[model samples]
Every structure is written in structure tokens, then in C-alpha cells.
Target: MLIAQLSDPHLRPKGVLYHGIVDSNAMFAAAIEHLNGLSPQPDLVLVSGDIVDEGAPAEYEFARELLSAIRQPLLVIPGNHDEREAFRRSFADFDTTSRSGPLHFAAGDFGPVRILGVDVTVPGLHHGDFDDDAAAWLEQQLAAAPGRPTIVMMHQPPFACGIPYVDEYWCRNGERLAALIARFPNVERIACGHVHRFMQLRFGGTLLCTAPSTTTAIALRFQADAEPASYLEPPAFLLHHWKEDAGLVTHLVPIGRFPGPFDFA
Candidate 1:
């Protein structure tokens, strides 16, 4: 199965600009166009989080239109910048319910392969959480599909990735999240966004990756004297492919075409 992952689009309402520099809406449109041009096309398009800048009604409308251009099924969840009520209202098709604490969503099952979208956004807070209800929901899903190859998706990464500013607001209940994930041997990978950079790490015996932002990045300034990584960086996303025999492989697809390949070696 082929899955295209795009994160942190941070798209704003029309005529609005993010941070007075990055053109988030334009960048996201570019990303959508690029993804639609893929050769075999993807079975699904997954937006890990930050689908909008402020969860504004207008922003969702724009996001919906842009995402509609994709010819494949699209799966998404809320990010720190997203509003839970707004997201639920927008994506009404997903079986969303209050269910005590956090909201849960799941879709698509190709026999032994299933995709699960879990919401971890804590309203009004920058950090994330898996809470007890969410943990139970995830466990139940994995348990029910013991023989299936499961791919878990969320907004914040469960592990630290050296970006202190982002790390500070990462998933707080990761220990519980990791522990819950370890029980499911069928789980092949965990995908997340929010850190505005492409990173890979291991957690709960599975691969975890953070997709690059389709919009601008959160200036890489780790501290006062540390250099900076900012909007100057090009936009990028991820293409994840999974096969019955080979497991899974992910490619970080940048938006713009690069100059002739240069030898890194």
C-alpha cells in the first residue's frame, strides 16, 4: 500500500500570512499538486496534524478544498494548532464521538493492513497526550487486529528529537503510549508530525517518523546562541510504501526540484 504523509501545513485564512513571511496556503497548495502527480498514486493521503493555523471555519474550508483535489481517500487528525470541535465538525464522516476524554478515528483495512488515526491534541495546550481512554482505544484496535499490519498515526512524536522547543511540547503520555503499543506485535510503524523537521526514531519496537512541514518550519533555534533553522528551508512531505513481503519504507519528498544530485560522499 502507498500512503502519502503531509504535516504541519499551518495553512491560514485567505489573505492572511503566517509569521509575516511563510505563505502557508500557497505552500500547501503546491504540496497537494505535487502529491497528485505521483505515478501510481497513493491508496491514502495522511495528514498527521496542523491542518490549519487556528482551526478557523474558513481555514477548514480551504483545507477541505485543497485536500479534495487528491483522488485518494484522505485521513487526518487534530494538531496543537487545531480545534477539536472544529475538526470534528469538519470531518463528520469519521466515526467521531466524545467518548469521555479524547476523540478517536480509524479507517481503511486491506485485509492484514489497517490504518488508525488517533487524536492526541490537548485543547489550548501545545503539548500532547494519549490519556487512558485513547490508550484503551488503541489497545482494543490492535488487539482486534492481531494478524493485521497496523500503522498508527498521531500529531506529536512519542520521543524527543533534539529540537528542544518542540520537544518541550511533545507527547506527555508517551511512556504509556509506548507501553500500550508494545503489546501489538502486528504494528509495523508509528507516524507523527508537529516537529517541523524530518526525523526517525524507534519506540515500542516500531519505527516512528516525523514528516517535514508542507508549510514553513519552526526556526531551528534550539537556544539563545544556537544557530537557526527557519522558513528559509524548503517545504517537504513523506511517501510511505508498504508491501506484504518487504514491510515498509518511507521517502522524504521535498516540494521543489533540487539542483543536479551532488555527491554527499
Candidate 2:
């Protein structure tokens, strides 16, 4: 099974640009076209978070309309920039039981892979956490299906990615999350967003990967004093392929046009 993951699109209202630079809406449209044109289309598409820039009703409406064009089944979670109420109302069809409380946490089976989506976003905060309620709920989901290949999805990455500016907002109580995941050997990987760049690390015996935003990318800075910044680096998304015997493998697919497919002469 092939699962495509797009993160942090940060779509804005019509004619609005993110940060007065990137055209998030246009970038997202291009990404949708690319995904639709894939030779072997993805069975499922997961939009990790940051569906809009300002978390406004109009912004969510715009994003919902754009995302409706995707052919594959799409799953979404909330990010720091997302407003829970507006986001819930926008994607209400995805989870009907999510009318109240944290926007739905559940396990879904897609072929051989089981997807566990958890809500870690804290309203009006730039950071995230898996509090007591979320932790207990996640544990229940993991226990329900043991030894099944599973992918955990959330907005904030639990581990630090070395960019001090971004690390400052890393998921709090991450240690608790790691501990819970350690007990579940079936957890193949933890997919995340918010960093706006591709990042990977091993934690709790599972791979933790952050997908790049389709709009723009965050600069890679190792210096502690480096200010928050973004760049025009080619945006991209992740394609995770699962095989019965080979397990899961991920490929980074860049957006936009480039010369390629020339046969070696």
C-alpha cells in the first residue's frame, strides 16, 4: 500500500499569500495535481496539520474546497495554526463523532496498515502535548490491535530537530509519548508536521519522520541564536510504501518542474 503524506500547507483566504511571500493556495493546488497524476496513486493521503494560515472560517472553507479535489481518502489533524472549532466544522464529514471534545482520535485500517491519529494540538499555543486524557486514549487504541503494522499521526514532532527556533515549540511531555510507543512493537513510524522541513529520527524503537510543507520550507540552522526563517527551497511531500515482507519504506517527492527522465546516452 502507498500512503502519501502532505504537511503544513497553511492555506490562506483567496488572493492572500502566506508571510507575504509564498502562495500557499497555488502550491497546494499544484501538489494536488501531482498526487492525482501519480502512476500508482496513493491509497490514502494524510494531511498532518496547518491546513490554514489564520485559522479563520473563510480560510478553512477555502482549504476544504481545495482538498475536496483529492481522489484518495484524506485524513487530517490539527496544528498550532489551526483552530479546533473551525477545523472540526470544516472536516466534519471525516469524523462525525468529533462534534465535541478533542477532534476525534481513532484507529483506521487501510489494507494491511492501521493508522492511529492522535490530537496533540493545544488551542492558541504554538507548542503541543499529549496530556493524561490523550495518553490514555492512545494506549487504548494501541492495545486494541497488537502486532499490526501501524502509523501514528500527529501535528508536532515529539523529538527535537536541532533547529533551535523550532525545537523551542517541540511537543511537551514527549517522553511520556515515547514510553507508550515503546511498548507497541507494531508501531512502524510516527508521522508529524510543524517543522516545515523533512526531518527523521529514531525514538522508542520506531522511526519519527516530519514531512516538508507544500508551501515553503524552514531553513536548516544549527546555531542556537538563529532566528526563525523560511526559504523558497523546493517544497515536497512523503510517500510511504508498505510491503508484506519488506515492511515500510519512505520516499521524498519534490514539487515543481525539473529536467529529468533523460536516458543515458
Candidate 3:
């Protein structure tokens, strides 16, 4: 199974641009085009939160139209910037059951690989957490499908990225999450977003990967008063390919490289 991951589009309403520079709408469009052009074609497309800037009704409106064009099945969760109610209303086709709207989740089986979308967004807060229910649900899901290679997806990472500002807001219940995941030996990786940078770490014997935002990347600064959140890093995403024999392999594929020769020897 091949999963294409896109994160942090921060889509805005028509005529509205984020920080007077980044065009969220155009960024997402390019991302969709790139995904569609891939040769083998991913079996699934995962949007790792921050779908819109302020979760405006209009922003969701445009977002739905763009994501609808993707050829494969898609999965999503909410981010700090996303409003759960608005996100649900915009993408009613997805599976959302949590009352707080932050824990919209779904489970799917692709042969020997079991994929789970875990929601860790905390409304009205910059940081994220996994409550009792989310943790319980994960445990149940893992137990139900024992010995199957699993890929868990969420917005906030379970490990700090060493970037102070983001690290401060790292998932509060991350330790508990790690302990729970450790029980499931089948878990191959934990894919996440929210820091806006390509980050990775080892958590409880599983690979923890943070995908770069489709819009902009946060500058690597530890200062408290870092005026701006993100800088002009080329938009990129992650592609995780799963095989029964090999478990999982991933790539940090950058976007917006046009007219470059395909052979980069």
C-alpha cells in the first residue's frame, strides 16, 4: 500500500491570502496535481490537518472541491487551526464520531496492513493531547487486529522536534500514547504534522515522522518572539509505501519543482 501525505494547506476564502503572501489555495491545487501525476498512483491520500487557515466556512467550501478531485480514498484529522464543526460540515463524507470534533477517526484494512487515523487536535489551544477515550480506542483497535502491520496517523507529534516553540506544544499525553503503542508490536510508523517541518524520531520502537507543510515551513528558530511562524521553504510531503514483506518505506517528496529533468543522476 502506498499512502500520499499532505499537510497544512491553510486554505483561505476567495481573495484572502495567508500573511499577505502564501496563496493557500494555489498550494493545495499544485499538491493535488502532483499526487495525480505520480506513476504507480498511491492507494490512499492522507491530509494531516491544518486543512484551512481559520476554519472559515468559505475556506472549507473551496477545500472540499479541491480534495474531491483526488483519485484514491482520502483520510483527514483536525489541527489547532481547524474548527471541528466547520471541518465536519465541509467534509461530511468523512467518518467523524467524536463530540469534540478533534477525534474524527477511521480504520481500514489493506491486506496485511491496518491503517488508523487518530485525531489529537485540541480546540482553542495551541498544543495537542490524547484523552482517555482516544487512547482506549487505539488500544482496542490494535488489539482487534493483532500482528498486522499498522500505520497510525495524527496531527501533533508524540516526540519533540527540538524546535523550542513547537516542542513546548508537543502532545501532552505523548508518553501515555507511546506506552500504548509499544504494546502493539505490529505498528510500523506514526505519521504526523503540526510543526511544519520534516522531522523524525524513534518512539517505542516505531518510526515517528512529521511531514512538511504544503504551504510554508516554520523557520528553525528557538526564540520566544519569533514574529512569523513559517518561512519560504519549498512545499513538500511524505509518501509511505507498505509491503507485506518489508513493512514500510517512506520518502520526503518535495513539490513545485517544475521543468527540472526527471533524471537527477
Candidate 4:
């Protein structure tokens, strides 16, 4: 199974740039085009979070218009920038249930891999939290599919990424969640977004990778007083391929055209 992960599009109302700098809409469109052109196209596309900038209805409508171009099955979770009501309204079809709550929590099988999409957004807060209910639900899902290769998708990473600015908003009760995950050996990878940069860390004997943003990137800084910053670095996404023998291998696919494939002579 092949899964393509894109994060932090942060789309705004048309004609507006996120932070008055990054042209999020254009970058997202390019990302869609890139995914559409992929050879052996991914079986699924997982959009980690931050689907819009202001979490407005109009913004979601605009995001919907752009995201409709993706040919593969797309799964989305909520980031701090996303409003559950607006996201639920715009992406009604993706929700696992029609009942009112945190948009949805979904789990399913795709070929040989099992996917679990969890919601960790805390309403209006910038930091993430996995509450008792969510943790228990995740534990049940993991227990149900013991020994199956599983991929966990969420918006906020459960570990610090060394950037003090982002680390301040790291998932609350992350250590507790890590303890739960530690019990599940079938959990192969935890895919996350929200940092707006590509980062990988080892946690609970598994890999936790934060995908890059489709709009802009967070400047890499480790100072305790570093202010939040963004740059127009090459927008990128991740591709996770699952093989029967090799488990999961990931590749970073960047946007825009670049020179390649000269004959090796």
C-alpha cells in the first residue's frame, strides 16, 4: 500500500496569503497537481491538518475546491487552526459518523495495512491534547487489530521537535499517550503535522514523522527565545510505501520542477 501525506496547507479566502507572505492556495494547487501526476499513484492521501488558515466557512469552501482535484482517497484530521464545525460542514463525507462530536475518529484497512486517524485538536487551543476518551478509543482500535501493521495519523506530534516555539504547543499528556502506544507493537508509525517542517523522531519503539507543509516552512531554530518564523522553502509531502517484507519506507516528494535524469555517462 502507498500513502501520500500532505500537511498544513493553511488555505485562506481567495486572494489572501497566509501571514501576508506564503501563497498557500497556489502551493496547495501545485501539490495536488504533483500528486495527480505521480506514477503508480498512491492508494490513499492523508492530510494531517491545518486545512485552512482561519477555520472559516468560506476558507473551507475554497479548500474543498482545491482538494477535490486529488484522485486518491483522502483522509483529513483537524489541526489547531481548523474549526471542527467548519471542517465537519466542508468535509461531511469523510467523517466516520454523523453524530455531533470532534469531527470524527476513523479506522480502516487498506490492503495489508490498517489506518487509524485520531483527533487531538483542543477546540481553540494552539497546543494539542489527547483526552481520556480519545486515548481509550485508540487503545480499543489498536487492541482490535493486534499484530497487524498499523499507521497512526494525527495533527500534533507527541514529542518535541527542538523548536522552542512549536515545542511550547506540543501535545499535552504526550507521555501518557506514548505509554499507551508502547503497548502496541503493531503500531509501526505515527504520522503527524502542525510543525510545518519535516521531522522524524523515535518514540515508543516506533517512528514519528512530522510532514512538511504544503504552504510554507517553519524556520529551523533551537534558541529558547526564538520567535516563530516561516520561509518560502520548497513545499513538500511524504510518501509511505508498505511492502510485505520491507515494512514501511518513506520518501520526501517536493513541489516544483527541477532538472533530473541525465544519462550517467
Q: Which candidate is the best by lDDT?
A: 2
Sort every candidate by TM-score, greatest first: 2, 4, 3, 1
lDDT of 2 at 244: 90
lDDT of 1 by residue, 123-207 (tens): 9998988888788888888887787888899998878776666678998889998888888878888999998888888898788
Candidate 3 lDDT trough over 10 residues, lowest sum: 95-104
What is the lDDT, from 0 to 100, of the residue 219 in candidate 4? Answer: 97
- Per-residue lDDT tens digits for candidate 3, residues 1-265, read 8989999899888778887898878888998998899989998888889999897899898888888889987888888899988887677766644555455565664345667878777778878888887898889888988787888988888777767778877788888999998888899989999989998888977889999999888989867665546787889989998877777998998887668577777
lDDT of 4: 0.87
The local lDDT score (0 to 100) that residue 190 gets in candidate 4 is 93
Candidate 2 lDDT over residue span 176-245, tens digit each: 9999999999999899999999888998889999999998888899898999888988989999999998
User: Candidate 2 has what TM-score?
Assistant: 0.97
Off by over 4 Å in 1: 94-101, 110-112, 221-229, 259-265
**TM-scores, all models, native as reference:** 0.91, 0.97, 0.92, 0.96
Q: Point out where model 4 deviates above 4 Å.
A: 95-98
lDDT winner, 2 or 4: 2
Worst 10 residues of 2 by lDDT: 95-104
Alpha carbon lDDT of each predicted model: 0.82, 0.89, 0.83, 0.87
